[model samples]
Target chain A: MSEAGEFDFIAQHLAPLSQGYEGAFGLTDDAAILADVPGLVITTDTMIQGVHFRKLEPWDLVARKALRVNLSDLAAMGADPHAVLLSITWPQAVRPAQMQRFVDGLKTDLEAFGIPLIGGDTTRGGELLVVTVTALGQCEHPLLRSGGEAGQDLYVSGTIGDAVLGLEVDTLAGLTGVHKAIVEDRHLLPTPRLKLGRELCGLASAALDVSDGLVADAGHLARASGVKAGIELDSIPLSSAAETWVRIQRDPIATLVKLITSGDDYELLFSAGPEKREEILAAAKRAGTHIARIGSLIEGKGVEVRTTSGELVRIDQAGFTHF
Target chain B: MSEAGEFDFIAQHLAPLSQGYEGAFGLTDDAAILADVPGLVITTDTMIQGVHFRKLEPWDLVARKALRVNLSDLAAMGADPHAVLLSITWPQAVRPAQMQRFVDGLKTDLEAFGIPLIGGDTTRGGELLVVTVTALGQCEHPLLRSGGEAGQDLYVSGTIGDAVLGLEVDTLAGLTGVHKAIVEDRHLLPTPRLKLGRELCGLASAALDVSDGLVADAGHLARASGVKAGIELDSIPLSSAAETWVRIQRDPIATLVKLITSGDDYELLFSAGPEKREEILAAAKRAGTHIARIGSLIEGKGVEVRTTSGELVRIDQAGFTHF
Candidate 1:
């Protein structure tokens, strides 16, 4: 823990994050007040040391990952970032410099995302560092997972499986050069796709960010919308690094299945009518984000994945289970 | 941890809390949307095991305390409770039944306050449980700590230092009967004073909940408002139980000073014009809460506690430090 008390800590270190935000009162008030807050979207995420990231990982990167995860949730709901509240549980043993680095990263992202830090509490407790971020967003009509129709086309933004690989980069033998950095960056920091989500607000029927593996998240959309999502295995987009990693494996199809089943992919997945494909393409172009037509939703109950040669892929599990 | 995963846990256990709140999407959506969110007040608090509570503390009371602390913050801002988001980090060793009790307590308070659970996240990891709650409130004009004037009369609601005594009740010999329970309950489950806060809306110039001890919190108000706060030691109100405990101490004045400097008193302290004394009494009466005239704000800086005969009292330390 730092030498400063909670009040001193806020005034000296965290108060700057609230600068330019009138409602934040430079975080001097007991609670922040937003004069106008219509159509607000709220999402929260918690990241812990040793659980979400390695103990030796840099604090700034950890802070970025924590903030981006919450932002990603806002994007999934088709909301633009508005403001944020952060609750940081500092382990007593960590250096104050590490925490300063984390705060610096928060400053960078708040500026980049154009969101202000409103109100939060800092406490010294527990053995592991924990950060819980609550991001409040604005949206006219949030695109929910339950809005999908059977005839709509399934589309996914950016490449998948890279973040999961990023977590295991050090363990994966012979994975070096740009491939290592590419995958590692995905784990350390993620793009929230707020602009892409904004573009899809009216164009797409259903949307969500894929964090708990593509297949498990598809199941979530399916269950919510009372439809089946069928993905063509060959059409699933992969980063060049993942492609290189996959080719060296003995069974490529099995390796691909493993990639899809692994979690931590922060990419937007949505469904739209076939007639709006061109419009979605234009939308993706405007957002400057890569998107691919992966599959389609059908009038059924769950999720299914099959190869071009008509082989069904069996997935034992699709994501992390807390228990 | 339970056999149920995150999705199943939400569906089976937590979805009921979100039933009437449409924005919560029955706790199924990635994020919740509040259609109208003007004049919003946002506050967050994080509580950790072994730090905030004992390892064997009952989960339901723990949950109640967590919820009330956030509510207390809202009350301090003179905002009505609107909604809540809870992020729980579960330990792997805890039984599911304990978590259920916590949920039950949350349900009780949510119904009692007419505040719905709008959104939250649940994750499992680490050796200790952590609960973080973000409360959203509404108010036209939030009562900030900086709104006080030098001539305003200072008042405190309920009694001071009961909670701190409650924490040390076991250690203080011969302290028994109703006094022990009163102090323990004050420590375990504090009243948020929402009604009193609402009553003080336009009446009080500055208001804040006393969480970080009376003297320290008064110092905060003084520093924020650029004024001075002086409290008479003889005029400070205390519960009958505390009066009895004080008489047994070696120096009652020293005990009172100790009480004022110790934290965890969740009482509302505010400043108002002396002309509004009668009106403030009526407001407190209607809210069914006790109020005491303690002192007044003066033109200057910092806080002072004086004996009725006009002698300055010295304080070594006013509150806890994170380090």
Candidate 2:
């Protein structure tokens, strides 16, 4: 109804982003106080409006997506979220309604994950909105992409490439009923797999979150771990919508490979010991998250996809390069 | 020379900036490993090109300026430098030469203060160039702005308003010789009184850095501490350059008032026990710093300046407001 003052804006909109996480003091004070934890893991990710997201997307979703992407980074390291600093590039011509709704979405995600927004900078900038979120996490020993051993089983949480399928279906005409709803939901609200990642802290040998297509991100893991990760082409966990959509158009294998390299899945790609496979499966079930046995880490570099006939297929590149 | 690879860019440019700091692991790893110390103080500030600095400014000066501003915050809280995270929004058109110079400048400041550039994010954005730095420090107990008590002495380290005057001269460009040099230096490099702030940790009742000119920032200290500060206008220290410049211009009081409200004076503004003034002054001298007693904390609601004629002048608003 009216313009909020600077202090009130911070108290209402920004502070709630870091509301309920353990060790994070309430944000009412000038600074957010955090308790000293054992193993602190900190990571920063910046999202630019046109570069990271289309302006056409709802402002509320933009706020959630910004927080989700940073959370995904913490999830990749198997770290528990403690607090985050949100540096926002406030765009000109942003209405009070938009600001309120945007902050509301930010609060929703923060309260859901129990992380508080600690400290941040606000500045006037161009039409392009920039949200830089630095997330602080704690772990006994962080799960790194460099720790994957040869012969370890590679598992991916939830389904892959649903966001891709959702994008395609949302653009095409005459897509109706449950298909439309599912596709839109997948695109708008990405699940960051925080619970699954926390469970995999000790269990996962090496891990990374799928941001840039499965194939590309998996390739990063393989390269970093100094091991080859071989995946069965048919074992990729594709959505029912993706299966139907691909059947109507191109060959499923080609489509699957393309999807793997497409990015924005936000699922966890992790390596665990072959001996621990049964334990991992049981844990995945208990977490209410899927774990698809996609591949196995082998002694070598480079990622190789195998045909059902055991034929090796080479991919040109693993993931998207920002440059 | 050929263009620098991403890894090389990090190793060459960033590694040197992290020198002389206590880091568990530096820029070599995917994530920085920071050892946690209890009572650690953290603060973040973001500066954008065009918003905070001009591109015409030397890369080294920009680097120095950015680090100084963030360091000012830590100094205000009476914290010692430990480590820093530098997030840069790089322009796509920037060549390696430009980046190299920028890195060189950043490295100078990092080395000077013994505050390492531990971790950061670099991303592409629009016309605006953003630099968000999070500086972390350790303190036994931080001197908060809300700690000042009635009957305490309010003091400011070094001189104030020179940086503001420097900004004015840089834009107008009608002055020359020492007049121009002092103003430019003030604008380009405003030192944070780190030693004084840390020394006053236990002795000082409350403290803060004066970025947003003296009168205004003192207002912040007063409001936070729940005590009103009374200032003698004659007690406000004016740089020789500021005084000479004022003599060349119109009414000295008006000019002084204008400079007092112009932001970007990175000096320490703090309150201490009246009895501890001598010890505070001696500690400042040992730290190779200077401080001037400007006012006293009194039982009231707001701040007022007493003139030479014993007239108390009420000044409500102080410094600059970005919004």
Candidate 3:
């Protein structure tokens, strides 16, 4: 079939995603008009193929990951997505079929996240897809990385590095059965912890999503909050299958250490007061999620990783640096 | 020398752009926290090298035009720019020297326009630079293309087709004169009609910026407003040099027709009633700009060109359509 026309395709798929968005204008004008709501939290993230993701991945997974990553940033700030602007760049050319499938996959994710792709730009460029999604959200006193107190407890939502482990599994040979598929799926589609983020907004002292590995992102949170963080290595949550997979790979401790340092976890790392700890844990359990009391804020700088042997491991490079 | 570091580069160049902007959460946080303000307007536009501009163009010119295009859209709604988010896809891997120059140019325009670069995403991709700018503005009642009424006088701000002629002269040889540099500058650095836009916001019934040529964009205004538009060729404010150049090369009338359909003339094409014509003229004078009565909206849908001899010439295509 001929490629879906831009206007028609947008009208059919994009309109539904924006339905019920309280705005004088949503998407049907020269520009999308949003009512000036209080506390507008806006964030933008761009992912380029080969740099952020490999083209070897499926189209659906790519679309899902791109949106999820941006959503993850909003979640870190405890914001609900209001609208999104998608600036899409296709390699000099894309097959009409491929483009259609890509747009369809994107449409599905936008609908799922309740964010309308309101406005953006499209252009031809070199090989690789570059998609920059700018999200407009609303929050009352957005959770900032700088809000953590020195004595506050640090907690993380969900397992730490299953996605990284999954990536390794996909590349290595001799891995078989359900474990491999599960690992690959984890690497492909990471669920942004939106519910826990919303619940922790008022309760948590400070927060940020783990994107550039646990160690690196932890440092970021600490630096932003101007407080050092101490994490007990044992407190880093690992999936049962992931743990077994790491153990089978050789030195389990080393493997786990490497995994924790690998980026793309998309989990929320937050701080909470001693009084709010029980309430936070209860909320996580009710939501069918796990909270790991990984660390606590300290009156210093950087991260201190305490090992099982009670020795602190100092990691200088915390996460991925794009530049 | 090592390339300029990302953080320091942003701090030095982009920090000043946010000076007078309201609620601009600098580059430190996860997102920009915009304070709740009524009557906010948003618009986005993207410029790609080889598609929107040539790589050989000066960095300052590219930065200025990239910003001007988006500003033109906001101006169409009679809004003043508050903040801008730039999503940049570098064709080659980013180098610090080139990046500094690019950012410096962007900073200059942002400061001149009183809009700050609040946030952006940078990614590596393709062989062409893609800069997508999303401008946020605020106005009481945004002027939309759908607000025109039948029998409204269709007018344009400043001159039309100067940029198109400039582009032609800059690319093709044999057109040697002061016109070459002046036209090239016009094509490179367009002054978006921000003042007229603000003044016309409440007065003009319908408005849109002329990006994709006058005829095509005027047609868009007509279609959006559900009215027919008729343009008088003689009334189009083509510069004397442009008229002379066209008269020597081809039929000036046909050239003018093509100019009306050529893209990249960042003028404002708006429709207002005769009652507001005097007020619009006065506003243009106050802004030290010219207003041209190019067309009129009627009770039909299609656009027609009125020749100097009174014969009507219908164009097959209105503007360039990039899919």
Off by over 4 Å in 3: A1-5, A12-16, A20-28, A90-92, A122-128, A166-169, A251-254, A314-316, B1-4, B20-23, B90-92, B123-128
lDDT of each: 0.86, 0.74, 0.76
Binned by DockQ into CAPRI classes (incorrect, acceptable, medium, high), candidate 3 is acceptable
Interface RMSD against the true structure, candidate 1: 2.2
Note the DockQ of each predicted structure: 0.68, 0.36, 0.48
- What tens-digit string does per-residue lDDT give for candidate 2 at B15-49? 77777444324453334556767766566666767
Strongest candidate by DockQ: 1
Leading candidate by lDDT: 1
Question: TM-score per candidate, in order?
Answer: 0.97, 0.91, 0.92
Per-residue lDDT of A41-85 in model 2, one digit per residue for the tens?
676767777666776677788889888877787787777887787
Write one digit per residue (lDDT tens) for candidate 3, span A147-226.
Answer: 88899899998887788767767565555667777777778888888777878878888888887788877887888788
Q: Candidate 1, residues B1-323: lDDT per residue as tens digits?
A: 43236677778777887757879999888899874856889999888888887787788988989999999999999899998999998886768798889988888888889888888888777788789999989888788898888888999999998988988878878677788999989999999999999888998999999887899888888888889999988778899888888989999888999889887788899999989999999999999999999999999988899998999998777654444
**DockQ winner, 1 or 3:** 1
Candidate order (DockQ): 1, 3, 2
Q: Write the per-residue lDDT of candidate 1 for residues A1-323, one digit (tens) a residue.
A: 32235667788878888766898988877899874857888999888888778898899888888999999999998899998999998887767788889988888888888888988888786678889999989898898999998988999999988988888898767666799899989878989999999989988999999887898888888788889999999999999999888888889888898888777788998999999999999999999999999999999987889999878888777554444
Quote the positional error of residue B97 for candidate 3 in Å: 1.3
